[model samples]
Target: MRVLVVEDELPLAKLIRQGLIADGLLCDVAIKGEDALWMADATPYDVVCLDVNLPGIDGFETCRRLRASGVATPILMLTARDAVEDRISGLDTGADDYLVKPFDFGELLARLRALTRRPAAAGGTEIVVGDLVLDPVTHRVTRGGTAIELSVKEVQILEVFMRRRGEVLSRLQILEGAWDNGYENRSNVVDVYIRLLREKIDRPFGVTTLKTVRGAGYRLDEA
Candidate 1:
C-alpha cells in the first residue's frame, strides 16, 4: 500500500522507504513535521510510518494534528523511545499502533496488514458478497467452495473494493491504498491490473461484479 514515512533521520527514512518498496508498497518520505502535515493533507495514504523523536513539532504533535484534521488513515509510530510513558504518549497522541526501534520487519508488516485489513461487512474476518469469500488474514479468495488464486497486489486491490462495496473508488484512491508513498508511475498500471483481475475473477463467472464508473473509477457489486 501507499505509505508516508515521517522521520527526521535521513538514513532511517530512506531505509524504511526502500524496505517498504521491496514489499510492494509505495512510500514517501518527510523529514520534518510541517512537511508531514502538508503531505498528509495533500495526499491519501493508507498508513503513515512515523518516528516519535523528531525535530520541531515531533511525531506526537503531527499525529495529533492529523487526527484533529480528520485524517483517519492508520498511523504506526516507530521510535527509539521504548519507555512506558513514551508508548502511552504516542497512543494518546492518536497513533493507532506503536512499534519501538530494533523491531523485526516481519512484525511491522504484520501490524501494517492488520491496519489495512477491512472488517467483514457483517463483522468478521471472512468478507462475503454472494458466494464469494475473502479472508484478509490469509489473503485467500474463494468462490462457492472453489478457491481462486490471486497475486498479492490483486488481493490487496480486491480487498479495497470489497471493503467499500458499492462506493466508487477513484483511481487515485486505489493507487494510494495499493501502493507506497512516492509512487511515481505515470503509466496505466491500475487499469492494466484491473483488467488482469477481471480476467481471473469475473470472466469465469456469468456474474458481473466489477464495474468501471465511466471516467470516475471502479466499484464492486455483489451478484
Candidate 2:
C-alpha cells in the first residue's frame, strides 16, 4: 500500500516514513498542507496521514478541501491536541480516523490495515485467487489449505498481485506497490522477488499461477 504523510516536523516525518517503509509499505512525505493537496491529487495513495497543525492551511482545512475535491482516500489525522472538540473537528472535516501524538506505532499500523481491509466500498478482509488465500487483517497466507511463509516484502508484493489477479503488472508497478520512493533498488530486484514468490507459492504445489509475459511484465491468474 502507498501512503502520503503530511507532517511539518522534519524528524517526525522521517521517522514515520521509515517505520512505514519497514513494514513494506510505500510512503511519500509532504511537509506542507498545500503540497499534500497536490500530491494527493496526483498520486493514488491507499491512505493519507495528515498532521493537524500544518503551515498555512491546517490539516482540518486540508481534509475539507480534499473531500470537496472528491478525493476519497482514507485520511488518518495526527494531532497533539487531545481535546474532544479537536477530535470532533477532525472527524467533522472528513478524517476517517484520528491518532494523537506519541501514539504507539503498532496501533497506527493496525488502524491503517483496518482502513484498507474495510474501505468505504463494501469488501471483505481477505483476498482469494484460486486456491490461494490471503488475510489482510491476520497477515496470513495459505495455498490449498497449507500455510505459506513470506517476508514482509514478499507479502506486500503478493498482496498487489492478489488484488489485481489476471492483470499484467510491470516491474515499476510492482515496485511502487511494495517499496517506498526512498528505495534505490536495481531493476532486477523485482525479478528476484518474483522468482522467490514462485518458489513458495507455485513450485511446491505444482502450480503455474504466476506467469511472465515476455517483455511485458508478470501476471497472476487463477490456477
Candidate 3:
C-alpha cells in the first residue's frame, strides 16, 4: 500500500517513513499541508497519516479541504494531545482515525490496516490475479500455493501490476506508482526491477503473465 505522511517534524516524518517502508509500504513525506494537498491530488495513496500540528493549514483544515475536494482516501490523524475535543474535531473534519504522539509503532501499523479495510477504501485487503495472490496487509505473495520471496520494492511493483492487471503500463507510469518523488526519474530502475520480478514470479513457474509490449511498456495478465 502507498501512504502519504504529513508531518512538520522532519526527523519524525523520516522515522515514520522508514518504519512504513520496512513493512513493505511505499511512503512519501510532506512537511506542509499545502504540499500534502497537491501530493495527494497527484498520487493515489491508500492512506494518509496526517499530523495535527503542521507548518501550514494544520491537520484539521487540511482534512477538511481534502474532503471538500472529494479525495476520499482514508486519513489517520496524529496528534500530541489526547484531549477528547481534539479527537472529536479530527473525526468531524473527515479523519477516519487518530493516533496520539509517542505511540507504539505496532498500533500505528494496525490502525492503518483497519482504515484501509473500510468500505470507502479503493482496494480490498487482498488482491488476486489468476493463480497469483497478494495480501497487502501481510505483505505476502504466493503463486499456486507456493510462497514467493520478494524485496520491499519488488513487492511494491508487483502490487501495482496486480492491482491493475491487463492494463498496459509505461515505465513512467510504473515508476510513479511504485516509487516516491525521492527517486530520480531518469534512471532505468523500472526495467531492472521488472526483470528481477519476472525471474521469480514467472521463469521459475514457466508462466508469462507479465508481458512486455513493444513500443508501449508492460502488462500483467493471467498466464
lDDT per residue, candidate 3, 1-223, as tens digits? 8899999999999999999888878899999999999999988889999999998699999999999999999999999989999999999999999999999999999999888888635756778999999886667899999999988888889988998999999999999888877778876889899999999999999999999999899999997
TM-score of each: 0.77, 0.91, 0.93
Question: Across residues 12-112, which tens digit of lDDT does each residue of candidate 1 receive?
Answer: 87887778776766688999888999899888777888988889999999999999999888999999888999899999999999999988888988888
Q: What's model 3's lDDT at 127?
A: 86
What CA root-mean-square deviation does each model show from the true structure? 3.3, 2.0, 1.9
Measured on C-alpha atoms, candidate 1 has an lDDT of 0.84
Question: Comparing 1 and 2 by lDDT, which wins?
Answer: 2
Q: Which 10 residues in a row give candidate 3 its minimum summed lDDT? A: 117-126
lDDT of each residue in 1-223, candidate 2, tens digit only: 7899999999999999999887777799999999999989988899999999999999999999999998999999999999999999999999999999999999999988877766733766779999999975566999989999998888889999999999999999888777776777798999999999999999999999999999999999998
Local error of candidate 2 at 133, Å? 0.9
Candidate 3: residue pairs that collide = none
Best by lDDT: 3
Worst 10 residues of 1 by lDDT: 116-125
Question: With candidate 2 superimposed using the best TM-score fit, by how many Å does residue 125's alpha carbon deviate from the native?
Answer: 1.1
Candidate 1 residue spans exceeding 4 A from truth:
24-26, 41-46, 72-74, 114-122, 167-173, 212-217
Please give the ranking of all candidate structures by TM-score, highest first, separated by commas: 3, 2, 1
Which segments of model 2 are wrong by more than 4 Å? 120-123
